[model samples]
Target: MKAVVLERFGGPEELRPADVARPEPGPGQVRVAVRAAGVNPFDGKVRSGAMEAVFPTPLPAILGLEVAGVVDAVGADVTGVAVGDPVFGFADTGSYAEHALATTVARKPEGLSWEHAVTLPVAGETADRVLGLLDVRPGETLLVHGAAGAVGSIAVQVAVAAGVRVIGTAGPGNQEHVAALGATPTTYGEGLVERVRALAPEGVDAVFDVAGKGALPDSITLRGGTDRIVTIADNTAHELGVVFAAGPQQRSAERLAELADLAAQGTLRTTVAATFPLVEAAEAHRLSDSGHARGKVVLTV
Candidate 1:
């Protein structure tokens, strides 16, 4: 199978198109003929070795985690998924390839495209997890930082659907876009706290910080506690007593199915910021690393 292999992690340029042995499914896994792969910030972190201390990948690792494709093989113990099934999920062996392996997956409804389905596993799962972690209930106000980006935007819609009022922070250009997602949007830099306060006079019930642009302190002040504040971007979460919601404690196949159903029903949505050919995985990673992409970046295989 052809894949964008990282001979050694360093930069986006390290991802090179090459032929590699196709991966076979292990126990409880399935092999997929990958149609598209989602490029995320964590993929860049893995490629650049920034997450080496926590997520160490060996040399010549494939550099993607989420994929949408047709399943061609299923391993022992696997159930509810089989050959010829159109599916999307997280891949343990990486997804930037012609074939990928997944231990858990959900059926891709006909309404969802490959590019869109591929974006859900990581970004959608994380958004749902943080909202669950906060136990954000209906009739409460929530503040979402980076609400215009992939994960943040999904978080906004999920919260809104649950009847939680959302106040999202984004660039001026994205304010209206966030508003369309059911949040009162505000610009992200200075005066963010004041802006949020102005929007939610009763104060926010919880804060979801996905941008990590030094907003943790203000979020703490607004929420009046670190218990209700969670972040995926800020490493200083521990120092500030905030929960670093990085692990997959709240993730599950059932949740992925629910998200896909929402997307299929036009309830949850994500824009394709850019799409690159399989050979141009490097460019996709560069766009993701730029931190300016307005939506999910994907690689068509």
Candidate 2:
């Protein structure tokens, strides 16, 4: 199998294309013939050794977290999914390869292309999880920072469809994009507090800080405490008494399926900023690391 292996962790330049042995599924797992792999910020964090303390991977490992592909082999005890199924899920063996291993695979909906399907596992899962954590209710205004990024974009739509008034933060150019997803768009920066205040005059009920770009202090000020503020990007959330929610336990195949169904029904949609061939994994990481891509970066096999 051809894979983008991280010989060492430091920079996107560390990722290199190489011929590695194809992974075989163990018990309760299945091997996927990867069609497209999702590139996440977490993948870059892992690649840079920033998350080594939390998600330690052995050196010379493949570095993607989610994939959309066809099931080529099923391990023992796997029932509902079978070989030849087009599936998308978290890739247990890392997904930056021609073939990867997955434990909780869900059938990819015909309505989604492989690139879009790959985004559901990570972006959708995170959005669903954070919304549950925030307990966002209909009629209440929820503010999301970085509202135009992959996970943030999904969160915006999910909150809106649930009947919540959503205010999302993005760049000036993405204001319309965020608004199109049913959120009142505000630019994130120096005057974010006033901007958000201008939109939600009644006050924000909760703050979901997906961007983590020093929005915590303002969020605390708006909500009167860290009780209603949660962050995924800033490691200093604990210092500010805010909740930092992450890790794989938050995602599941069921959540991915729900997101897929939403996309199939034209309710939830994923933006593909760009797609790179498997060999250009390095370039893909470069874009992801820049943190400026407006949508999910995908790698096609």
Candidate 3:
């Protein structure tokens, strides 16, 4: 199998294309002939060794979190899903390759493209988890940081669909785009608190900080405290007494299936900012790390 391997954790250049042994599924797992892989900010952190304390990847590891592809083989104890099924989910091994192993997967809807399918697993799971954790109710006001980006955009849409009023923060270039996603758009930076306050005079019910660009202080101010505030990208979460949502606790095949169904029904919109060949995994990481990509970055096999 042709895969990009990280020889060492330092930079994007550490990821090099190599012909490696294809991964075989373990018990309760399946091997997928990957069609597309989603490049996440977490992958960049892993590649650069920033997540070592939390998600220690062994040396010479293949780095990818989510993928969409066809199941080529099923391992013992696997049920419902079979070989030849089109699926997408969390990659048990790594997804930046021609083939990867998956323990959690949902059948891909026929109406969804592989690229779009790959984007759902991580972003959908994260957004749903944070919202649930915050206990956001319909008619409540929610503030989302980085609303124009992949996960933030989905979070905004899902919250809006649930009847929550969303105030999303993004760049000036993406303000209109955020508004279109059913949120009142505000630019993130100084005066963000005032802007969000103006949008929600009753004050924000919860804060979803995906940008992690030091927005926690303002979020605390808006929410009046750190309660119901969750951040997926901020490293200062612990120091600031904010909940840093991580791990696979909220990921499941059922949730992914719901997300896939919503996306297939055109209720959930996903954007692919750019596509790179598997060999250009390094370039993909660079783009994702730039934090300026307006949508999900994908690698095509």
Model 1 scores a TM of: 0.95
The list of candidate 3 runs beyond 4 A from truth reads: none
- Of 1 and 3, the candidate ranking higher by lDDT: 3
The candidate that wins on lDDT is: 3
After superposition on all C-alphas, the RMSD of every candidate to the true structure, in Å, is 1.4, 1.1, 1.1
Top-down TM-score ranking = 3, 2, 1
| TM-score list, all predictions | 0.95, 0.97, 0.97
Superposition error at 124 for model 3 (Å)? 1.1
Task: Write the residue-wise lDDT of candidate 1 on 1-301 in tens digits.
Answer: 8999999878889999899999888899999999999998888888998888887888878888888999999999999998999999888788999999998789999999999888788887898789988999999999999988888888898899899999998888887899899999899878877888898989999999988888999999898878799999887899999998776445578888888888888888877889999999989988988877777999999
* Reference-based lDDT, each prediction: 0.88, 0.88, 0.91
- Report residue 239 deviation for candidate 3 (angstroms): 1.4
Per residue, candidate 3 scores C-alpha lDDT tens digits across 160-250 of 9999999998888888889899999989999988887777888888999998899999999887788999999999999999999995567
Which tens-of-lDDT digit does each residue in 1-301 have in candidate 2? Answer: 7898999988888988899898778899999999999999888888999988877889988988888999999899898899999999998988999999989878999988999888777777787788889999999999999888888998898899899999998988999999999998888889877877788778899999888788899999888778878888988898988999986576577778888888877888788879999999889989988777888999999
Report backbone clashes per prediction: 0, 0, 0
lDDT of 1: 0.88
Cα RMSD for candidate 2? 1.1
> Which pairs of residues have clashing backbones in candidate 2?
none
lDDT of 2 at 199: 81
